[model samples]
Target: MSLRRRILILVAVVCVLAGVAGLSFLRAADRAEQRGRTQAGGPEIARGGLSLTPGEDGPRIVFRNMAWGPNRDELASVPAAAPEGARTASGVSCLRFHSAGGTGICLQAVKGGVQDGYRAVVLDARLREVSAHRLAGIPTRARVSPGGLRVAWTVFVGGDSYAGTNFSTRTSVLDLGTGRLDASLEDFTILKDGKEFRNADVNFWGVTFVADERTFYATMATGGRTHLVRGNLAARSVTVLRENVECPSLSPDGKRLVFKKRVEGLPAEAPWRLHALDLTSGTETPLAEERSVDDQVVWRDDRTVVYSLPGDFGADLYAVPADGSGAPARLMASALAPAFLG
Candidate 1:
């Protein structure tokens, strides 16, 4: 072959080889992104849908796929219970039952040998995993709307403690019906004293939604003070209802709110007491179980409240009367989060 012809042919071969290699690299990268790993080292993708029809059996307390009857000792594993054929991802930090039918779970998986962000997993009434979304911060709280059309969560990014300095939180809401996700409540406009309010140090967490999906309640902390505020999801705005409320859980009847109030004359290590506020009468009554409760209270029903407290073994669930009567009674021996399985 002529020298010039030989040089041209060699150059063409090199270019072709380079192009093929580049395409292969791009395809590999795309596959890795799709097959993300769960904290339990399983594929993060959802499986097929499963039947969510409740058994003829009565109501059950569901934690993950495990169901416990009235007798805590009679526990049965129902790993196949997820509706829509979805399974609970491993490394779930929190789980809440959706009133409409389904479950919302927050997974805190580890990536690159460090605590990665959280994943909000949605399961249908049949207990099938339906959708999953990546979220920012450490999962601190997770809640589903009364109708199961909405999911809300709170994550703590940086801070040693709730009352510690230099910590922040992100509260987000997702509309399953609309497939719209609000990653942060900080974007919502705040109305304090009937005027627009904005501040750099504002932080929000502990979101509780009412029966009406458009209206909700959350904790907003700013200027070293925590206030309970009622929010309108449609308007994207909040109106301060009261102050000194950390985490508020709305009553099923929508007539009262149960929350933790910082009690005076107590050591800073544990200074909160559970209290119920009557929304109409504006009366705050402390519950009879006086041990420092540092958890967002859950209303098991109109008259009973459930919460978690730390113990030597782990966090245990307890129940108390909402009307400031009866002592704290232990329900679950070592359950961190408790929600009624609807």
Candidate 2:
């Protein structure tokens, strides 16, 4: 072919490719706009004053609102007695959140040039920033101690892991009272089977604190096995309690723990089954929910527990008997990371 003919063909190819790229960009933008629109039959959400301060309202519940529209992903609240009622959005957004004793731990993205940057922000009762710490990765789990004196969070750092994914976690604990931070739980002493354990691939996540504030529980993974470990803040140590336990949430009375357990023969996409563990008797009772739940559950009461499951609008809250008796019931739609307050 002549040189002029070849040049014309190349220009035609470039134009075709440009058109295809433009069409894809428009489609993506349209999808993003659709997400901002309110979906029919979804929960009602409106902007309003939200406070973590307890005892004013008659038992309210705060959560990350997963509902569609302008308030989506913001910290929201509704009366605990009527979780299905209209939500009041706080306008503060977080990827993961939890609160107790009038304080909140918000794991949120840092909006700006750095797209992947995130931070763990300590918030006051009125949702004001008390302090912020730069995070090294994507935020996953967050918790504030029962006394509100401590906060903990976990972020996903990329890597191929024993759990069969390119995922790893950095769990950190911060003393709100003293402003002291343990940047990674991996820094603490690990006691496994009555001996100090150390490994390069160890990862920790899903922290739950007891009433004493210093005592807590978290999931530790190493060598392809996960264990529930009792953590001591003062001593900076963790003792492995049992194997195959992940995301353990202590009962309100602190006598039992509701956790996710990996069941054999299940698909890797959804491998966990909720189970209640009796601390005194060392008994594990599988809950009635047959579907896999991948959440760190919260105790609604000593007898009941609440957790999130995948839903049309991201996630929904569900409740089940802590004793593994009654069937699971949907508590609220389009909500995640609930914290009950009086």
Candidate 3:
């Protein structure tokens, strides 16, 4: 071969080797970063293409009115703000629940891995959309404000998740009318992207607000620990109220709170029970000694608390009396998120 041709071939081989080595270094660096995430605890990095864009003025959230099933038939039903034996009929894909003031509540729909990327939609009587908007990726727990001015939810980006199986979840709030999202929740971590969590580390869920709009509460977990936090939004500060509890639902009067507490000897997937807390004194009382409690809860009145319990991939809604005297909670319907408008 000519000298020039041999030299050109040698240069090409060197460049190919360099490129492969560089790629290998990058892969190694990625693995090392993933490993570092295992011990890190801080606000999570936002992922997915969820937008928390700027928008118009905020609107009030009334209890939503909705009918289940397709168009007509007894199987189709509408819900009032308060539960007077409200039952979800079969063949229903989605139903609507109203807030106490009659404004419809907003449900954030999202994918399994990415909790923050959500579409907030209000369902009317026919399971039709009354209004809808997108939001920033926040692993939020929220409630309708007293004046119905806002749907108050906690904001946090999870620090860790089950690695690749988990997409990052963040927390933030939205203006009911304009659909503008403002994320100001304090430090929380989420899973490093592309990693799978063998178990859930912690993600924000469970949102309850007082009728007076004076307080908001939610649960946060990390490093195998769970905590219930009460936030004074007006003050822009938060206080850690307790540990090992979640899915808090406040009573109508805003004096009592209901939630699920992880039990000692129950399956990880379904090991929680209903409990109540007095906001005035921070004293907690068991509302149900059930084998386990469900995931979400809301007050039917000062006397009753309603929540979403996991049956499997899908979940069921149940109501338990705060007074602690009732038949093991009754099934309200085949829904995941439950709210009362009364």
Among these predicted structures, which one has the highest lDDT? 2
Tell me the tens digit of each residue's lDDT in model 2 across 196-246.
999998999989899998999999998888999999999999999989999
Provide the lDDT at 165 for model 1. 45
Q: Candidate 1 on 1-342: residue-level lDDT in tens?
A: 999999999999999999999999888756643442223332133223223333344344443322221212111111313321222222233333323345454443435645545577776665446788776767677777777778888777886467454789988899888888888899999999899999999999888889888899899999988899999999999998789998899998999999988878877878889999999999999999888887887777799898887853446668899999888887654345545654
TM-score of each: 0.74, 0.87, 0.57
Evaluated against the true structure, the overall lDDT of model 1 is 0.69
Query: 1 or 3, which is superior by TM-score?
Result: 1
Kindly report which residue stretches of model 1 are placed more than 4 angstroms away from their true locations once superposed.
1-55, 64-100, 110-115
lDDT of 3 by residue, 12-34 (tens): 99999999999999897676444
RMSD of each: 13.0, 7.7, 17.9
In angstroms, the error of model 3 at 248 is 1.1
Ranking by lDDT: 2, 1, 3
- Candidate numbers, best TM-score first, in rank order: 2, 1, 3
- Count of backbone collisions in candidate 3: 48
